[model samples]
Target: MTYSSGSLINQKKWILLFHFIIGAIIGVLLLHPLTTMVFWYEYKGLIEFPGNSPIEFLIQRLITEFKFELMPMSFVFALLGGIVGLLFGLYHIRLSGQKNLVRSLEHELAEELPLLIARGESEHLEFKSTYRWDVRQQRTNRALESIVIKTIAGFLNREGGTLLIGVEDNGNIIGIDSDFQTLKHKNRDGFERALMDTVKTSLGGNACALLHCRFHDIENKTICRVIVESAVEPVYYHEDSVARLMVRTGNSTRELDAREAHAYLSSRTTKSFSL
Candidate 1:
Protein backbone atom coordinates (compact mmCIF):
# COMPACT_ATOMS: atom_id res chain seq x y z
CA MET A 1 0.00 0.00 0.00
CA THR A 2 3.02 2.22 0.39
CA TYR A 3 5.78 3.09 -2.09
CA SER A 4 9.46 3.62 -1.23
CA SER A 5 10.95 7.10 -1.29
CA GLY A 6 13.72 6.11 -3.72
CA SER A 7 11.31 4.88 -6.40
CA LEU A 8 9.16 8.00 -5.99
CA ILE A 9 12.19 10.22 -6.42
CA ASN A 10 13.25 8.36 -9.58
CA GLN A 11 9.74 8.60 -11.02
CA LYS A 12 9.61 12.31 -10.29
CA LYS A 13 12.94 12.91 -12.01
CA TRP A 14 11.83 11.05 -15.13
CA ILE A 15 8.46 12.81 -15.29
CA LEU A 16 10.10 16.19 -14.84
CA LEU A 17 12.65 15.45 -17.54
CA PHE A 18 10.00 14.20 -19.98
CA HIS A 19 7.78 17.22 -19.48
CA PHE A 20 10.74 19.58 -19.75
CA ILE A 21 11.75 18.11 -23.11
CA ILE A 22 8.19 18.30 -24.47
CA GLY A 23 7.69 21.83 -23.23
CA ALA A 24 11.01 22.97 -24.66
CA ILE A 25 10.11 21.56 -28.07
CA ILE A 26 6.76 23.35 -27.98
CA GLY A 27 8.44 26.60 -26.94
CA VAL A 28 11.02 26.41 -29.74
CA LEU A 29 8.28 25.77 -32.29
CA LEU A 30 6.20 28.71 -31.07
CA LEU A 31 8.96 31.22 -30.41
CA HIS A 32 9.69 32.32 -34.00
CA PRO A 33 6.11 32.85 -35.21
CA LEU A 34 5.06 34.35 -31.87
CA THR A 35 7.95 36.77 -31.86
CA THR A 36 7.31 37.58 -35.53
CA MET A 37 3.65 38.31 -34.82
CA VAL A 38 4.58 40.62 -31.94
CA PHE A 39 7.14 42.43 -34.05
CA TRP A 40 4.68 42.80 -36.96
CA TYR A 41 1.98 44.15 -34.64
CA GLU A 42 4.33 46.64 -32.91
CA TYR A 43 6.03 48.02 -36.02
CA LYS A 44 3.69 47.22 -38.91
CA GLY A 45 2.93 50.86 -39.85
CA LEU A 46 6.17 52.25 -38.48
CA ILE A 47 8.52 50.29 -40.79
CA GLU A 48 8.89 50.43 -44.61
CA PHE A 49 10.46 47.89 -46.95
CA PRO A 50 11.35 47.57 -50.69
CA GLY A 51 9.07 44.54 -51.41
CA ASN A 52 6.17 44.49 -53.93
CA SER A 53 3.62 43.05 -51.44
CA PRO A 54 3.01 43.18 -47.64
CA ILE A 55 3.36 39.40 -47.37
CA GLU A 56 6.76 39.57 -49.12
CA PHE A 57 7.82 42.39 -46.84
CA LEU A 58 6.74 40.41 -43.74
CA ILE A 59 8.64 37.33 -44.97
CA GLN A 60 11.81 39.42 -45.45
CA ARG A 61 11.44 40.83 -41.94
CA LEU A 62 10.84 37.36 -40.48
CA ILE A 63 14.00 36.02 -42.14
CA THR A 64 16.05 38.95 -40.94
CA GLU A 65 14.60 38.69 -37.38
CA PHE A 66 15.24 34.93 -37.24
CA LYS A 67 18.91 35.41 -38.16
CA PHE A 68 19.42 37.90 -35.34
CA GLU A 69 17.19 36.68 -32.45
CA LEU A 70 16.38 32.96 -32.90
CA MET A 71 19.18 31.46 -30.84
CA PRO A 72 18.96 33.81 -27.84
CA MET A 73 15.13 33.85 -27.80
CA SER A 74 15.05 30.04 -28.07
CA PHE A 75 17.18 29.70 -24.94
CA VAL A 76 14.94 32.08 -22.95
CA PHE A 77 11.77 30.33 -24.14
CA ALA A 78 13.21 26.86 -23.40
CA LEU A 79 14.13 27.86 -19.87
CA LEU A 80 10.69 29.33 -19.28
CA GLY A 81 9.12 26.18 -20.72
CA GLY A 82 11.24 23.98 -18.44
CA ILE A 83 10.17 25.88 -15.34
CA VAL A 84 6.50 25.52 -16.34
CA GLY A 85 7.06 21.82 -16.97
CA LEU A 86 8.63 21.38 -13.52
CA LEU A 87 5.59 22.97 -11.87
CA PHE A 88 3.19 20.67 -13.75
CA GLY A 89 5.31 17.62 -12.94
CA LEU A 90 5.38 18.45 -9.25
CA TYR A 91 1.60 18.99 -9.22
CA HIS A 92 0.89 15.54 -10.71
CA ILE A 93 3.45 13.49 -8.76
CA ARG A 94 0.91 12.23 -6.20
CA LEU A 95 -1.62 11.37 -8.93
CA SER A 96 1.06 9.44 -10.81
CA GLY A 97 1.95 7.51 -7.66
CA GLN A 98 -1.69 6.54 -7.07
CA LYS A 99 -2.05 5.35 -10.68
CA ASN A 100 1.10 3.21 -10.36
CA LEU A 101 -0.16 1.69 -7.11
CA VAL A 102 -3.51 0.86 -8.71
CA ARG A 103 -1.85 -0.79 -11.68
CA SER A 104 0.38 -2.88 -9.39
CA LEU A 105 -2.64 -4.03 -7.35
CA GLU A 106 -4.56 -4.94 -10.50
CA HIS A 107 -1.69 -6.99 -11.87
CA GLU A 108 -1.35 -8.92 -8.60
CA LEU A 109 -5.11 -9.50 -8.36
CA ALA A 110 -5.38 -10.76 -11.95
CA GLU A 111 -2.81 -13.44 -11.20
CA GLU A 112 -4.35 -14.46 -7.87
CA LEU A 113 -8.05 -14.32 -8.82
CA PRO A 114 -8.65 -18.03 -9.24
CA LEU A 115 -6.97 -18.82 -5.94
CA LEU A 116 -8.94 -16.10 -4.21
CA ILE A 117 -12.24 -17.46 -5.57
CA ALA A 118 -11.35 -21.01 -4.61
CA ARG A 119 -10.55 -19.86 -1.12
CA GLY A 120 -14.19 -18.70 -0.89
CA GLU A 121 -15.54 -15.43 0.43
CA SER A 122 -13.56 -14.02 3.31
CA GLU A 123 -13.03 -10.63 4.90
CA HIS A 124 -11.46 -9.52 1.64
CA LEU A 125 -13.53 -11.48 -0.87
CA GLU A 126 -17.24 -11.85 -1.73
CA PHE A 127 -19.14 -13.48 -4.59
CA LYS A 128 -22.45 -12.62 -6.23
CA SER A 129 -24.58 -14.77 -8.51
CA THR A 130 -25.12 -11.95 -11.05
CA TYR A 131 -24.63 -8.21 -11.40
CA ARG A 132 -28.24 -7.14 -11.93
CA TRP A 133 -30.21 -10.37 -12.56
CA ASP A 134 -32.33 -11.97 -9.89
CA VAL A 135 -32.24 -15.76 -10.21
CA ARG A 136 -35.17 -16.14 -7.85
CA GLN A 137 -37.46 -13.86 -9.84
CA GLN A 138 -35.91 -14.70 -13.20
CA ARG A 139 -36.00 -11.00 -14.09
CA THR A 140 -33.81 -7.94 -14.37
CA ASN A 141 -33.66 -6.30 -10.93
CA ARG A 142 -32.46 -2.71 -10.73
CA ALA A 143 -32.39 -2.91 -6.93
CA LEU A 144 -29.47 -5.35 -7.06
CA GLU A 145 -27.34 -2.55 -8.46
CA SER A 146 -27.67 -0.84 -5.08
CA ILE A 147 -26.41 -4.00 -3.39
CA VAL A 148 -23.37 -4.03 -5.68
CA ILE A 149 -22.64 -0.36 -4.91
CA LYS A 150 -23.00 -1.05 -1.19
CA THR A 151 -20.47 -3.86 -1.34
CA ILE A 152 -18.02 -1.64 -3.23
CA ALA A 153 -18.49 1.22 -0.76
CA GLY A 154 -17.98 -1.25 2.08
CA PHE A 155 -14.61 -2.28 0.66
CA LEU A 156 -13.57 1.35 0.10
CA ASN A 157 -14.43 2.24 3.68
CA ARG A 158 -12.43 -0.69 5.02
CA GLU A 159 -9.14 -2.36 4.04
CA GLY A 160 -10.54 -3.04 0.56
CA GLY A 161 -11.87 -6.32 -0.92
CA THR A 162 -12.67 -8.15 -4.16
CA LEU A 163 -16.18 -8.86 -5.42
CA LEU A 164 -16.76 -11.59 -7.97
CA ILE A 165 -19.88 -11.44 -10.08
CA GLY A 166 -21.25 -14.49 -11.97
CA VAL A 167 -20.30 -16.72 -9.05
CA GLU A 168 -22.54 -18.14 -6.37
CA ASP A 169 -21.99 -17.84 -2.64
CA ASN A 170 -21.00 -21.53 -2.61
CA GLY A 171 -18.40 -21.00 -5.41
CA ASN A 172 -20.34 -21.96 -8.52
CA ILE A 173 -19.48 -20.38 -11.91
CA ILE A 174 -22.85 -19.30 -13.29
CA GLY A 175 -21.58 -16.67 -15.76
CA ILE A 176 -23.06 -13.15 -16.25
CA ASP A 177 -25.10 -13.92 -19.37
CA SER A 178 -28.39 -13.16 -17.66
CA ASP A 179 -27.06 -9.80 -16.55
CA PHE A 180 -25.83 -9.02 -20.05
CA GLN A 181 -29.31 -9.56 -21.46
CA THR A 182 -30.44 -6.51 -19.51
CA LEU A 183 -27.82 -4.21 -21.01
CA LYS A 184 -28.11 -2.40 -24.35
CA HIS A 185 -24.65 -3.40 -25.59
CA LYS A 186 -24.91 -6.93 -24.20
CA ASN A 187 -21.13 -7.36 -23.94
CA ARG A 188 -18.26 -7.17 -21.46
CA ASP A 189 -17.55 -3.55 -22.35
CA GLY A 190 -21.16 -2.59 -21.69
CA PHE A 191 -21.18 -4.43 -18.38
CA GLU A 192 -18.05 -2.64 -17.22
CA ARG A 193 -19.53 0.74 -18.08
CA ALA A 194 -22.74 -0.04 -16.20
CA LEU A 195 -20.81 -1.25 -13.16
CA MET A 196 -18.52 1.77 -13.05
CA ASP A 197 -21.41 4.16 -13.61
CA THR A 198 -23.20 2.68 -10.62
CA VAL A 199 -20.10 3.09 -8.47
CA LYS A 200 -19.55 6.65 -9.67
CA THR A 201 -23.17 7.65 -9.06
CA SER A 202 -23.45 6.19 -5.59
CA LEU A 203 -19.91 6.36 -4.25
CA GLY A 204 -18.64 9.52 -6.02
CA GLY A 205 -16.35 9.71 -9.06
CA ASN A 206 -13.14 9.24 -7.08
CA ALA A 207 -14.27 5.81 -5.85
CA CYS A 208 -14.23 4.56 -9.44
CA ALA A 209 -10.46 5.24 -9.55
CA LEU A 210 -9.91 2.92 -6.57
CA LEU A 211 -11.65 0.04 -8.33
CA HIS A 212 -10.24 -2.26 -11.04
CA CYS A 213 -12.63 -4.55 -12.89
CA ARG A 214 -11.48 -7.53 -14.95
CA PHE A 215 -13.16 -10.46 -16.66
CA HIS A 216 -12.04 -14.09 -16.78
CA ASP A 217 -13.01 -17.14 -18.81
CA ILE A 218 -13.28 -20.28 -16.68
CA GLU A 219 -15.13 -23.52 -17.47
CA ASN A 220 -16.46 -21.83 -20.66
CA LYS A 221 -18.11 -19.15 -18.55
CA THR A 222 -17.27 -15.48 -18.16
CA ILE A 223 -16.76 -14.03 -14.69
CA CYS A 224 -16.32 -10.41 -13.63
CA ARG A 225 -13.96 -9.61 -10.79
CA VAL A 226 -13.84 -6.18 -9.14
CA ILE A 227 -10.78 -5.39 -7.07
CA VAL A 228 -11.26 -2.40 -4.75
CA GLU A 229 -8.53 -0.52 -2.97
CA SER A 230 -8.80 1.08 0.43
CA ALA A 231 -9.74 4.73 0.01
CA VAL A 232 -7.50 7.51 1.31
CA GLU A 233 -10.56 9.15 2.86
CA PRO A 234 -14.00 8.00 3.95
CA VAL A 235 -16.36 7.01 1.10
CA TYR A 236 -20.09 7.26 1.60
CA TYR A 237 -22.82 5.64 -0.50
CA HIS A 238 -25.39 8.24 -1.52
CA GLU A 239 -28.97 7.10 -2.06
CA ASP A 240 -31.89 9.54 -2.59
CA SER A 241 -29.98 12.43 -1.00
CA VAL A 242 -28.97 10.32 2.00
CA ALA A 243 -25.31 9.39 2.45
CA ARG A 244 -24.60 6.22 4.41
CA LEU A 245 -21.36 4.69 5.63
CA MET A 246 -20.91 1.01 4.91
CA VAL A 247 -18.02 -1.27 5.92
CA ARG A 248 -17.01 -4.90 5.57
CA THR A 249 -17.81 -6.85 8.72
CA GLY A 250 -16.51 -10.43 8.40
CA ASN A 251 -17.93 -11.74 5.10
CA SER A 252 -20.83 -9.25 4.95
CA THR A 253 -21.34 -5.53 4.39
CA ARG A 254 -22.90 -3.52 7.21
CA GLU A 255 -24.06 0.07 7.61
CA LEU A 256 -22.82 2.19 10.51
CA ASP A 257 -24.66 4.82 12.53
CA ALA A 258 -23.34 8.37 12.76
CA ARG A 259 -21.65 7.77 16.13
CA GLU A 260 -20.05 4.51 14.93
CA ALA A 261 -18.93 6.21 11.69
CA HIS A 262 -17.28 9.02 13.65
CA ALA A 263 -15.46 6.56 15.89
CA TYR A 264 -14.42 4.46 12.90
CA LEU A 265 -13.02 7.43 10.97
CA SER A 266 -11.26 8.70 14.07
CA SER A 267 -9.52 5.35 14.69
CA ARG A 268 -8.81 4.76 10.99
CA THR A 269 -6.24 7.58 10.98
CA THR A 270 -4.03 5.74 13.49
CA LYS A 271 -4.68 2.14 12.40
CA SER A 272 -6.32 0.00 9.76
CA PHE A 273 -9.64 -1.77 10.41
CA SER A 274 -8.55 -4.84 8.46
CA LEU A 275 -9.10 -8.15 10.22
Candidate 2:
Protein backbone atom coordinates (compact mmCIF):
# COMPACT_ATOMS: atom_id res chain seq x y z
CA MET A 1 0.00 0.00 0.00
CA THR A 2 1.62 3.17 -1.25
CA TYR A 3 0.87 5.87 1.30
CA SER A 4 -0.13 9.11 -0.34
CA SER A 5 1.73 12.28 0.73
CA GLY A 6 -1.67 13.85 1.49
CA SER A 7 -2.46 11.14 4.04
CA LEU A 8 0.99 11.60 5.57
CA ILE A 9 0.31 15.32 5.94
CA ASN A 10 -2.99 14.47 7.64
CA GLN A 11 -1.17 12.12 10.01
CA LYS A 12 1.18 15.00 10.81
CA LYS A 13 -1.78 16.74 12.48
CA TRP A 14 -0.42 15.20 15.69
CA ILE A 15 2.35 17.80 15.57
CA LEU A 16 -0.28 20.51 16.12
CA LEU A 17 -2.18 18.31 18.55
CA PHE A 18 0.93 17.85 20.67
CA HIS A 19 1.45 21.58 21.00
CA PHE A 20 -2.23 22.09 21.86
CA ILE A 21 -2.09 19.44 24.58
CA ILE A 22 1.07 20.92 26.09
CA GLY A 23 -0.32 24.43 26.07
CA ALA A 24 -3.65 23.23 27.54
CA ILE A 25 -1.86 21.39 30.30
CA ILE A 26 0.11 24.45 31.28
CA GLY A 27 -2.90 26.76 31.01
CA VAL A 28 -5.15 24.46 33.02
CA LEU A 29 -2.60 23.81 35.72
CA LEU A 30 -1.71 27.50 36.04
CA LEU A 31 -5.03 29.21 35.24
CA HIS A 32 -8.00 26.91 36.08
CA PRO A 33 -7.44 26.64 39.86
CA LEU A 34 -6.48 30.32 40.13
CA THR A 35 -9.51 31.50 38.17
CA THR A 36 -11.92 29.27 40.12
CA MET A 37 -10.54 30.36 43.46
CA VAL A 38 -10.63 34.04 42.48
CA PHE A 39 -14.19 33.78 41.12
CA TRP A 40 -15.42 31.80 44.11
CA TYR A 41 -14.03 34.31 46.55
CA GLU A 42 -15.03 37.40 44.51
CA TYR A 43 -18.52 36.34 43.46
CA LYS A 44 -19.78 33.67 45.86
CA GLY A 45 -23.44 33.87 44.93
CA LEU A 46 -22.89 34.43 41.18
CA ILE A 47 -20.60 31.38 40.80
CA GLU A 48 -22.68 29.07 43.06
CA PHE A 49 -22.84 25.48 41.79
CA PRO A 50 -24.11 22.36 43.49
CA GLY A 51 -22.06 21.27 46.52
CA ASN A 52 -18.20 20.90 46.45
CA SER A 53 -17.25 21.24 42.78
CA PRO A 54 -13.83 20.21 41.52
CA ILE A 55 -12.05 22.85 39.46
CA GLU A 56 -10.62 20.08 37.22
CA PHE A 57 -14.07 18.75 36.42
CA LEU A 58 -15.44 22.16 35.46
CA ILE A 59 -12.37 22.98 33.41
CA GLN A 60 -12.40 19.61 31.63
CA ARG A 61 -16.09 19.96 30.81
CA LEU A 62 -15.58 23.50 29.50
CA ILE A 63 -12.68 22.28 27.37
CA THR A 64 -14.61 19.34 25.96
CA GLU A 65 -17.82 21.22 25.22
CA PHE A 66 -16.29 24.38 23.84
CA LYS A 67 -13.18 22.76 22.31
CA PHE A 68 -11.24 25.32 24.37
CA GLU A 69 -8.55 22.67 25.01
CA LEU A 70 -7.32 23.52 21.53
CA MET A 71 -4.78 25.82 23.19
CA PRO A 72 -2.31 24.66 20.53
CA MET A 73 -4.74 25.92 17.89
CA SER A 74 -4.75 29.36 19.51
CA PHE A 75 -0.97 29.25 19.71
CA VAL A 76 -0.68 28.23 16.05
CA PHE A 77 -2.98 31.09 15.06
CA ALA A 78 -0.88 33.54 17.08
CA LEU A 79 2.33 32.18 15.57
CA LEU A 80 0.96 32.47 12.06
CA GLY A 81 -0.20 35.99 12.82
CA GLY A 82 3.28 36.90 14.04
CA ILE A 83 4.88 35.41 10.96
CA VAL A 84 2.54 37.34 8.69
CA GLY A 85 3.30 40.54 10.58
CA LEU A 86 7.06 39.94 10.23
CA LEU A 87 6.71 39.35 6.50
CA PHE A 88 4.78 42.59 6.11
CA GLY A 89 7.44 44.47 8.05
CA LEU A 90 10.16 43.01 5.87
CA TYR A 91 8.23 43.97 2.74
CA HIS A 92 7.89 47.57 3.97
CA ILE A 93 11.61 47.71 4.65
CA ARG A 94 12.35 46.51 1.15
CA LEU A 95 10.01 49.09 -0.32
CA SER A 96 11.62 51.91 1.67
CA GLY A 97 15.06 50.76 0.56
CA GLN A 98 13.96 50.83 -3.07
CA LYS A 99 12.55 54.35 -2.66
CA ASN A 100 15.84 55.60 -1.19
CA LEU A 101 17.79 54.02 -4.03
CA VAL A 102 15.60 55.73 -6.59
CA ARG A 103 16.09 59.10 -4.89
CA SER A 104 19.87 58.66 -4.88
CA LEU A 105 19.89 57.74 -8.55
CA GLU A 106 17.87 60.83 -9.42
CA HIS A 107 20.24 63.13 -7.52
CA GLU A 108 23.31 61.60 -9.20
CA LEU A 109 21.78 61.93 -12.64
CA ALA A 110 21.04 65.60 -12.04
CA GLU A 111 24.65 66.22 -11.10
CA GLU A 112 26.07 64.42 -14.15
CA LEU A 113 23.78 65.70 -16.87
CA PRO A 114 25.49 69.05 -17.44
CA LEU A 115 28.97 67.57 -17.46
CA LEU A 116 27.92 64.95 -19.96
CA ILE A 117 26.46 67.57 -22.25
CA ALA A 118 29.57 69.71 -22.03
CA ARG A 119 31.84 66.75 -22.79
CA GLY A 120 29.79 65.86 -25.83
CA GLU A 121 29.81 69.42 -27.13
CA SER A 122 33.53 69.85 -26.55
CA GLU A 123 34.26 66.75 -28.59
CA HIS A 124 32.24 68.01 -31.56
CA LEU A 125 34.18 69.20 -34.62
CA GLU A 126 32.79 72.75 -34.52
CA PHE A 127 33.96 73.32 -30.94
CA LYS A 128 37.50 72.36 -31.95
CA SER A 129 37.76 75.15 -34.57
CA THR A 130 40.05 78.17 -34.14
CA TYR A 131 37.22 80.69 -34.64
CA ARG A 132 36.48 81.31 -30.99
CA TRP A 133 34.88 84.74 -30.45
CA ASP A 134 34.06 86.35 -27.12
CA VAL A 135 30.88 88.09 -28.18
CA ARG A 136 30.46 88.67 -31.88
CA GLN A 137 27.12 89.31 -33.57
CA GLN A 138 24.63 91.19 -31.47
CA ARG A 139 21.27 91.65 -33.12
CA THR A 140 18.91 92.21 -30.20
CA ASN A 141 20.92 90.90 -27.27
CA ARG A 142 17.56 89.56 -26.01
CA ALA A 143 19.49 86.72 -24.46
CA LEU A 144 21.47 89.29 -22.53
CA GLU A 145 18.36 90.69 -20.96
CA SER A 146 16.83 87.27 -20.51
CA ILE A 147 19.74 85.48 -18.88
CA VAL A 148 21.90 88.25 -17.43
CA ILE A 149 20.34 88.12 -14.02
CA LYS A 150 20.34 84.34 -13.89
CA THR A 151 23.89 84.19 -15.23
CA ILE A 152 25.22 86.61 -12.68
CA ALA A 153 23.48 84.84 -9.85
CA GLY A 154 24.90 81.49 -10.92
CA PHE A 155 28.38 82.86 -11.43
CA LEU A 156 28.36 84.50 -8.03
CA ASN A 157 27.09 81.36 -6.31
CA ARG A 158 29.62 79.04 -7.93
CA GLU A 159 32.76 79.69 -9.97
CA GLY A 160 32.28 82.28 -12.67
CA GLY A 161 31.96 81.35 -16.37
CA THR A 162 31.77 83.17 -19.69
CA LEU A 163 28.52 84.52 -21.11
CA LEU A 164 28.90 84.42 -24.91
CA ILE A 165 26.18 85.95 -27.05
CA GLY A 166 25.85 85.60 -30.88
CA VAL A 167 28.70 83.11 -31.03
CA GLU A 168 27.73 79.56 -31.95
CA ASP A 169 29.08 76.57 -30.02
CA ASN A 170 31.33 75.70 -32.97
CA GLY A 171 32.63 79.30 -33.03
CA ASN A 172 30.29 80.50 -35.72
CA ILE A 173 29.15 84.15 -35.91
CA ILE A 174 25.48 85.05 -35.60
CA GLY A 175 24.88 88.76 -35.28
CA ILE A 176 22.06 90.37 -33.32
CA ASP A 177 20.50 93.50 -34.84
CA SER A 178 20.35 96.73 -32.87
CA ASP A 179 16.53 96.93 -33.06
CA PHE A 180 16.24 93.66 -31.19
CA GLN A 181 18.64 94.81 -28.50
CA THR A 182 17.29 95.80 -25.10
CA LEU A 183 16.74 99.49 -24.50
CA LYS A 184 19.49 99.46 -21.89
CA HIS A 185 22.08 97.62 -24.06
CA LYS A 186 25.15 99.82 -24.67
CA ASN A 187 28.85 99.66 -25.43
CA ARG A 188 31.40 98.12 -23.05
CA ASP A 189 31.42 101.05 -20.58
CA GLY A 190 27.67 101.55 -20.68
CA PHE A 191 27.07 97.79 -20.58
CA GLU A 192 29.14 97.50 -17.43
CA ARG A 193 27.11 100.22 -15.80
CA ALA A 194 23.89 98.46 -16.71
CA LEU A 195 25.18 95.14 -15.42
CA MET A 196 26.30 96.71 -12.14
CA ASP A 197 23.03 98.47 -11.70
CA THR A 198 21.04 95.27 -12.18
CA VAL A 199 23.33 93.34 -9.90
CA LYS A 200 23.07 95.96 -7.19
CA THR A 201 19.28 96.04 -7.40
CA SER A 202 18.82 92.29 -7.35
CA LEU A 203 21.86 91.05 -5.45
CA GLY A 204 22.70 94.16 -3.35
CA GLY A 205 25.69 96.49 -3.61
CA ASN A 206 29.24 95.09 -3.36
CA ALA A 207 27.77 91.79 -4.47
CA CYS A 208 28.42 92.89 -8.06
CA ALA A 209 31.91 94.00 -7.04
CA LEU A 210 32.69 90.45 -5.98
CA LEU A 211 32.63 89.60 -9.69
CA HIS A 212 33.77 91.37 -12.87
CA CYS A 213 32.28 91.79 -16.33
CA ARG A 214 34.21 92.62 -19.51
CA PHE A 215 33.07 93.00 -23.15
CA HIS A 216 34.90 91.28 -25.99
CA ASP A 217 35.30 92.71 -29.52
CA ILE A 218 34.82 90.43 -32.54
CA GLU A 219 35.42 91.37 -36.21
CA ASN A 220 35.49 95.05 -35.21
CA LYS A 221 31.94 94.57 -33.89
CA THR A 222 31.09 94.68 -30.20
CA ILE A 223 29.50 91.80 -28.25
CA CYS A 224 29.02 91.81 -24.51
CA ARG A 225 30.98 89.37 -22.39
CA VAL A 226 30.59 89.09 -18.67
CA ILE A 227 32.85 87.17 -16.27
CA VAL A 228 32.04 86.80 -12.60
CA GLU A 229 34.34 85.51 -9.89
CA SER A 230 33.50 83.01 -7.22
CA ALA A 231 32.51 84.58 -3.96
CA VAL A 232 34.78 84.27 -0.92
CA GLU A 233 31.97 82.19 0.49
CA PRO A 234 29.26 80.28 -1.32
CA VAL A 235 26.60 82.73 -2.51
CA TYR A 236 22.98 81.79 -2.79
CA TYR A 237 20.93 83.56 -5.46
CA HIS A 238 17.57 82.88 -3.89
CA GLU A 239 16.29 81.62 -0.57
CA ASP A 240 16.39 77.90 -1.19
CA SER A 241 17.65 76.72 -4.57
CA VAL A 242 21.36 77.27 -5.01
CA ALA A 243 22.00 79.32 -8.12
CA ARG A 244 22.97 76.76 -10.77
CA LEU A 245 26.51 77.19 -12.18
CA MET A 246 26.24 77.20 -15.93
CA VAL A 247 28.95 76.83 -18.56
CA ARG A 248 29.01 76.92 -22.33
CA THR A 249 28.20 73.57 -23.89
CA GLY A 250 28.74 74.14 -27.57
CA ASN A 251 26.31 77.01 -28.21
CA SER A 252 24.16 76.24 -25.19
CA THR A 253 24.65 76.69 -21.47
CA ARG A 254 23.92 73.90 -19.05
CA GLU A 255 23.60 74.26 -15.28
CA LEU A 256 26.05 72.44 -13.03
CA ASP A 257 24.75 70.47 -10.09
CA ALA A 258 26.06 70.18 -6.55
CA ARG A 259 28.99 67.87 -7.33
CA GLU A 260 30.26 70.09 -10.14
CA ALA A 261 29.88 73.12 -7.92
CA HIS A 262 31.91 71.41 -5.22
CA ALA A 263 34.58 70.40 -7.70
CA TYR A 264 34.76 73.91 -9.10
CA LEU A 265 35.30 75.44 -5.69
CA SER A 266 37.85 72.80 -4.80
CA SER A 267 39.95 73.18 -7.97
CA ARG A 268 39.74 76.97 -8.23
CA THR A 269 39.93 77.93 -4.58
CA THR A 270 42.66 75.49 -3.69
CA LYS A 271 45.32 77.10 -5.86
CA SER A 272 47.91 76.87 -3.06
CA PHE A 273 47.54 73.10 -2.81
CA SER A 274 49.44 72.31 -6.00
CA LEU A 275 52.02 69.61 -5.35
Give me the candidate number with maximum TM-score: 1
Which numbered prediction scores highest in lDDT against the true structure? 1
Stretches of model 2 off by over 4 angstroms after superposition: 1-146, 175-181, 184-186, 238-275
Task: Give candidate 2's TM-score.
Answer: 0.34
- Whole-model lDDT, model 1: 0.84
Clashing pairs for predicted structure model 1, backbone only: none
TM-scores of the candidates in the order shown: 0.61, 0.34
lDDT per residue for candidate 1 within 6-114, as digits (tens), equals 9868878899999888777766556544665676667777885446555675566556643655568767777777777778877788777689887787678667767
Question: Under the 3 Å rule for N, CA and C atoms, how many clashes does model 1 have?
Answer: 0
Report the lDDT tens digits of candidate 2 across residue range 38-122: 6665666676553455565456534543365665554554455445545554565567659967767656744543343344333
Could you tell me the lDDT of residue 148 within candidate 2? 52
Q: Please give the distance, in angstroms, between residue 245's alpha carbon in candidate 1 and its true position after superposition.
A: 3.5
